[model samples]
Target chain A: MSLSVKHLLGIKELNLQDIEQIFQTADNFKKVLQRPIKKVPTLRDTTVANIFFENSTRTRLSFELAEKRLGADVVNFAASNSSVSKGETLIDTVNNILAMKVDMVVMRHSASGAPWFLAQHIDASIINAGDGINEHPTQALLDAFSMRERIGELKGKRITIIGDIMHSRVALSNIYCLAKLGAEVTVSGPPTLIPKHIASLGVKVEYNVKKALEWCDVANVLRIQLERQHKPLFSTLREYALYYGVNKSMLDSIKKKIVIMHPGPINRGVEINSDVADSKQSIILDQVENGVAIRMAVIYLLSGKREME
Target chain B: MKTLLNSGQLNITLQRLSHQLVENHLTFNDTVIIGIQPRGILLSDRIVKMVKKISGNQQLEYGKLDITFYRDDVASRDIQVPNDTNIPFSIEGKNVVLIDDVLHTGRTIRAAMDALLDFGRPKKVELLVLVDRRFSRELPVQPDYSGHTVDTILTQKVVVFWNEKDGKDEVILIDKL
Candidate 1:
């Protein structure tokens, strides 16, 4: 078998075998983490470009760390600091970067499918870090990996993704990966925010938080859309939190050994209660640690020398 | 006639197998061996042990995976304990060899691959089984490395027991009467 993956654009593009290959590769890199020297010369000659069109600290840092750990020369590009502010088109900017002969581009863009577009146009391998409200495949993969580490298996597990489902790329990606792994996933938010057609993708849509929480083994609390407040998406933050936030009282209602997860830049005291955010059940930190390993796995699997046998 | 492999034969086979694995340059710069539970994992442990004794690299990471949840038969019958699928190491950018005790219908390896993805990605994945019984395969799959290949009928069963289970390591050919 020959292993080759040039680009990691989305979760939907991966088959079961491709996903396993990434996981297995990531498993090998775990050794470098334990050693006193946590750097490898595997990708010593490769250059990785981190192009973030949106504001992100955690994701950007993790990608940077992963690239550096794997011995790839990393170049960070932020919209505010780059030529984009000078009215350069994305294609022009990408072309300018491509002229430098970078090996791979990890992009976080505000427009949905921007990475997909770049993947089609560019010669370099593209990895979608986050793309608008469409998908954050790597985050979803790390979350799946984290959950698998804790729960052992994904089949038949009830996973409740609670909060602003409509504007969440995390929710979309998680739903896709979880469903693919045989999990029974539920997406719950205010009726206005939960897309009606989302159920077609093998996910249950819930308007009531309590009902969804009652049956979940994993409660993935998503950050509410503070930016959507004045757009008539919902009435008020206080009301939404009162109805949907995973507070201590709501957390007490579930008897299963539940794990709490949040993709960070968390709006503490809002989407998740303060206590629960710091509780023993919280794997938010684990999600961050796993993010590096997951991205490392993705990069290594896609860029490593393929074995044809 | 009953075909049997004693404990000593099994050990010798394993040493030869490990030597062959090294000779093929299968131990790439970044590679991981993941054992399919429960017997496959034990086999992986022994392979890792032998690899360490030969090279002393200490970089070889091993993982144990339970493919029950990912099995196609899960929907058909009741499942017992879905044991821990632990790969404390990451698989990204590494060559992966999935170790197993015996290769039969290939369905188990297929299921193991499905279960393996929940962890992370690997550069490549190769199947390594102790015994490759050349029976009718339900799936288009074969082991990359095998201790031995035995041609068997559909009615025959290949049983491999370790000392941990049966006080010795041996292979048994049993007819389903």
Candidate 2:
């Protein structure tokens, strides 16, 4: 199925069929990645802009690589280094960039709905790389792609996301993605970190990480948002580790080997143990690897034909 | 509207092509058969088996290539799912035989040529197509080995159905609806 939407604002805006089509296209692109010549000329004539309003390493690199591999001309704009630091409005900044014939914009901002707001004013397609605690659509797609690769169909699969659900864009996107794809999703962490009325999204709530791990096929753990939290000391790193940390011991307790996933910049012992993250059960790298292909699928679908330019 | 080759005729054409390949490169030493992916894969697989049988060469290297990304119309049409490119060994100095089911626009062949160049330079390259549609050329590409020549317009599509996977072997002209 062809993607009808011009901008991939968020997973909340997408249905199950749209996500599956992205996965289906991603499946083919993954094979292309395994070839001797990894690059494809599909997006040869298109151009992409990666506008990051926040600091990032994985998402930026993953998107840049995906765009480059698809043969699109890419330009990166960091808010910290760009005119956004000089008090330039996002509309003026993006419109100035689009004035130079930029075809698409993949932006990651600290403010919630930054991408949504940008999409309203831009003529070019806007892909929400990450927008505050709102959504990271590509991450959700890649996470679901990796899970679907390992465990056949995502329908009825048990997955529990552990860490700061309230602050994580990954958690919000994953919950919507997993739920829409027919997974039994559960959010587990300190009660304070869990989003309000999250249970209303139809996900089971679990406070204990051990209980969450015991009852799931995949543990999609997120890093604790320490830098974002300061005013209210909900839980210390030492205190969070005792309850939510996914270590080798906790993994051993579960008879069935569950897949471990973390959307990078891991807080190691705080969110999940290094051993568990590096273990055979860990598909963290696979998630990282799939990130590029998923991004390519998203970019290509959204960019449309080069002649349309 | 017209049938080019029936099941029996297709088998005969493939056997003849296999004989021609063996005659050119005896015993298949320093030769690799690479098929343009998605469709040409089956044709190459069939030809490789027949060539192995005819030449008594069991160690013939065969691979599949996808040229979706190398197309000229990438800017014109919606890019669909790409196929797998599997070439395990190096093609440094080997004589490569590029195989595909049909030669229509010749753009597929051109893209395949570009895709193949990413792999190490082959000593020589030969093109083989099952059905060569005459007079509708977008690129200046001609097949070195061809099964049958058919005249068609821009509106018609030449479809080659294999016996093993497609349940019956036949070539039919499908006009645009």
Candidate 3:
């Protein structure tokens, strides 16, 4: 039922049926995850390489665990300790690993389109963990997975993605995924942080945070890219908090019980306040739990031996 | 095409199987009924209903398992949409009856057994099938209890319809044209 793609480069490449198929596969793996023994021998005959050029904790560990749980032999390689430190090209690094018989690769690189570039030249199936500000396909998959778990079918549901959109791979991937699934997606943040010509991608850009929150059934507050900022995007952190930070008082003002979501490493008091992030309506933890299942589905689907009916 | 068993014959076969289960396991304290997911669940549900009616007790443990991830031919065949697995209790030291609608290449049963071992080690595991498509098993596996055995060719397929969803219980064999 999956689309015939060797690499999961971005959500831009997936259609509605591919997304549905991955969700359906994730649903099967979710049942396996809940069992007393969460390991399956589906990929025992295969091996994987997790190559992370960017610093990450959650995505890396989730992919590693997902690969192991599927019974695949996994080898992790971070840029700092790998041949990349010696100035090796991306293709060279990946090809070296593939020479050892690695069947698949899960890569997280700082440059946008890095996974796509490697996928074209490499023999192994490439999964984009996060490719700079371009896309994080698995994150988007888990986000949609969590949303479907809480809100059921996404068709016609209003989803408001908040915070820094221009620098968020999560937002980009989510916009592609949610829009394709028939959801009315809107992006809101500082005017400068919002990308140019985003409306062409089929989403409304609302500058007012309150109006965006009011219009949405689910509000996904992404972490502001403090590290990626070279010049100040806003006047100050306090100024950003005043206009964008979602606090208890701000949330309490709204009568509707809206689901709150954040792609972690949450910057408390920056994009959203502590109370709101830890609130009963928050599904950050559920997103993390579903992350493993999403990665499992991605890996299982992209395995070299894709059997088509 | 030929009908191996119609509604009346199907019900009698399931009832007889349930009685045989009761005669062997007695109170069923150490027994658990597990159905292969998707189609086998309908047959398993019918069996559970018959057993509960005959014993006047609804305490027997029953569950459904999907073997999609455990299948040996996953990489070589079309990927199947997996159903749900709902086992609330452990199979440790228990007698397990693994049920399915048909016994084809015996691969499905083999995959089910592999999945079952992950939950816990059972004292023994048995197989029950509505249609035993003989002479085509690819593995060294056999059913302990069977409703009926059909002699089939390589080019033919066996389709089982149940009253629970198909409006009536029936088994029909078809040849590939």
Top candidate when judged by lDDT against the true structure: 3
TM-score of chain A of each: 0.95, 0.97, 0.97
| Deviation from native of the Cα of residue B161 in model 1, angstroms | 20
In candidate 3, what are the lDDT values of residues A88-171, reduced to their tens digit? 998888889999998888999999989888877977788999998899999999998999999999999999999999999999
lDDT per residue as tens, model 1, B52-128: 77756577787888764355542134322334567787787778889999899998898787666656677788888
The predictions' CA RMSDs to the true structure, in order, are: 12.4, 2.4, 2.2
Off by over 4 Å in 2: A31-36, A233-235, A305-309, B164-167, B174-177
Tell me which residue pairs clash in candidate 2.
none
Q: What lDDT does the true structure give each of the candidates?
A: 0.80, 0.88, 0.89
lDDT of 3 by residue, B87-169 (tens): 99989999999999999999999999999999999999999999999999999999999999999988999999977698888
| Cα-based lDDT at residue A17, candidate 2 | 72
Ranking by TM-score, best first?
Answer: 3, 2, 1
Better of 1 and 2 by TM-score: 2
Evaluated against the true structure, the overall lDDT of model 2 is 0.88
Q: Which candidate number would show the highest DockQ if scored against the true structure?
A: 3
- Residue-level lDDT of model 1, residues A1-309, one tens digit each, is 213456787887777666666666565555446544566554666789999999898999999999998778999899998889889999899989979988789999989999988877877888999998889989999898889888877989889999989989999998888877889999888998888799888888878888888878888999875653447887777787788888877777767658999998888777888889999999999999888888887876666432211
**How far in Å is the alpha carbon of B83 misplaced in model 3?**
0.8
